[model samples]
Target: MALSEREQQVLRDLESQLHQEDPGLADTMDSRTTGPLRLSPRHIGAGVALVLVGMSLVVGGVVVRNSVISILLGVVGFGMAVWGVTLALTRVEAGGGPGSSRRPSRRSSFMDRQSQRWDRRRGSQG
Candidate 1:
């Protein structure tokens, strides 16, 4: 059987309260969010671009028959490629800000009513 009108109303009221409390909580937890942890092909492409540029430099050095310059370009190009790829693929944690139950942060943990005691002690020393 369908839910009674009262049951539906209660659900709606609870939803309203929850949304008002944290408007984006639903969006954050959406499985479709995919987090910010993965790298896209575009990131890899950029790194490869760096490598190509470095390879071109090496080619130029070759035309001049300069082994030292070729080596330098190769090193620079390889470094750029590595750095670009590294930067593109980092992920940060997802927290439900404020009242979302993630628990206290390292900084916030030590900043509670204990501050009052510390303040009183400091005041006495002053």
Candidate 2:
């Protein structure tokens, strides 16, 4: 999904506000996190090559009249092809990507409160 120009501007404005309020945090967040799982051309190529090799292996086994070997090669080829397709189709974005700038939800707030309480309790006991 692509963001509209207005939405992009809003995000930029929010980021500026954040930077002004917390320069230290802003500096810490300057790193570009890797985007989601995307199959690079290299990975796709490697996967395709693997599938091809496996298929060839299966064909060779069949030519040699070895049922067990043929079956094993076929399974390997299928698995490799599936893995390649999955890698190519699935994409995951890391931090700094779209929708990553949103504030934490209520559940996250609750978890933070609970963690703080636990820390306080431990400190008092100690």
Q: Pick the candidate with the highest lDDT.
A: 2
- What range of 10 consecutive residues in model 2 has the weakest lDDT sum? 89-98
TM-score of 2: 0.36
Model 1 bad stretches (over 4 Å)? 1-36, 88-126
- lDDT against true structure, model 2: 0.68
- Poorest 10 consecutive residues by lDDT, candidate 1: 90-99
Off by more than 4 A, model 2: 1-39, 92-126
- Per-residue error (Å), model 1, residue 51: 2.4
- Residue 5 lDDT (model 2): 100
Task: Give the C-alpha miss distance for residue 49 in model 2, angstroms.
Answer: 1.7
The CA lDDT of each predicted structure is 0.65, 0.68
Error of 2 at 45 (Å): 1.8
**Residue 96 deviation, candidate 1, in Å?**
16
lDDT of 1: 0.65
Model 1 lDDT per residue over 3-65, tens place: 999999998898788778887885565444654444455556766676667566656656755
lDDT of 2 by residue, 1-126 (tens): 999999999999998998999988877676334234444555456667766765676566577667787777777767766776665554443322245466445657888999999999999999
> After best superposition, candidate 1 residue 30: deviation in angstroms?
17
